[model samples]
Target: MIEVRRFKKRFGSKEVHRGVSFHVEQGECLGLIGGSGSGKSVLLRSLIGLEKADSGSIVIEGQDITQMTERELIGIRKKVAYAFQGGALFDSMTVFDNLAYPLREHTDLKESDIKKKIRDLLFEFGLADSENLFPGSLSGGMQKRVGLARAIILNPDTILYDEPTAGLDPFNTRKISEMILRLKAKKKTGILVTHDMPVAFEVCDRIALLVHGNLDIIAKPKEIQQDALHPISIFAHGDIT
Candidate 1:
């Protein structure tokens, strides 16, 4: 559903993405794993036009987003939802309002329908009672669940996750992984950018290791595990000494 080819991005004298290329098929969750400063987040931003690439093509379902204008991108953004690392919930909005914001902005669904949708999502994410609470009142795990619930409330075809399990406890991390797996079962495409190796192995159908601004290896979890000498193995499992 998504294709990136020869993608290159730079920050002044520093280059972030150098000819990086990869694809995520429909119903597949591809994990993007990399060390610090590897530009994984920047690549995710570029997919949504939050960051412009210097030269390359990012095509989603046959449309090249690299050349799309802000107006043109509105439609694409609806089909591609991004779940930010820190939840990114509106501090001023209540949890219910935050969850309803996208539907109110993007769809003509009636207020009643919107409410139903929000309630269903909250229940699905195990947050049925959090609607009235503010983001600050929630725990880190609750906030992450709320962020994910908001991201999928619109039923976008593609979901881009940035550090979904960054600071959560093991239980919450497992919850996040289960959520990703649930999304995959429903045939949603996803690109998960995370440093959590266990989450990657548990949820992603394929894992792509980013090294030196490009995908050094893309393989299934078992393949990655079997190839001890592969760069991904080295990075994910450490030097097997």
Candidate 2:
């Protein structure tokens, strides 16, 4: 489980997140929704210690990470994986190399064990045959799959997805949504940052809508569709409040 209590973040003079708080239960897939610059991404970053919070606390499982030293945070970060926006794959390396990079750096596993893990991950991502291909050679959707394979290579307890379905056609977008559902079934807690309502409704177990640097609502998808508090649902679906 994770908790964000009265979190606040600032950049220069701009306060990105102001007094934001929420909780994600273990094995829960929570969607963070908001328009651009609404602080959804900032919140995700803060939760994983990628971005420091100027005030408030982010506790994961019971550890308050707001004041942890860099060395202390490293161990905590290993259990949290992040799938960045646009599936940021290494353009120079082959898919196999990209996926193997994490295990090489983080774990003391032997070469054979690493190879076996990489093979399994590639197979799971449906890119077993494309392991030798560079990111440039594969299509955008394939690249995204490789990126996801790499992120899960460490088998992190919690995964943070930043715009997982951006820049894809409807077909690829749905594929990623299905992947999110599959990940949830595996008991991986997911924090998805996206503005796509349909994707949220399909994949997320719960949705938290951010408006004006605060969480407007956190409810089940069915409740969100029925409730009238979320302004984005009104504009995105033309539902009367």
In terms of lDDT, which candidate is strongest? 1
What digit string (tens of lDDT, one per residue) describes model 1 on residues 1-241?
Answer: 8999999999999988899999999999999988888899999989999998899999999999999999999989999999999899999999999999999998999999999989988988888999999999999898988999888888999999999999999999988899999999999999999988888988899999888887858999988778888777898775521
Candidate 1 worst ten-residue window by lDDT: 232-241
TM-score, per-candidate, Cα-based? 0.97, 0.92
Q: Which parts of model 1 are misplaced by more than 4 Å? A: 239-241
Query: Where in model 2 is the C-alpha error above 4 Å?
Result: 228-232, 238-241
lDDT scores in order: 0.91, 0.84
> How many steric clashes does model 1 contain?
0
True-structure lDDT of candidate 1: 0.91
Q: List the residue pairs that clash in candidate 2.
A: none
How badly does each model clash, as a count of residue pairs? 0, 0
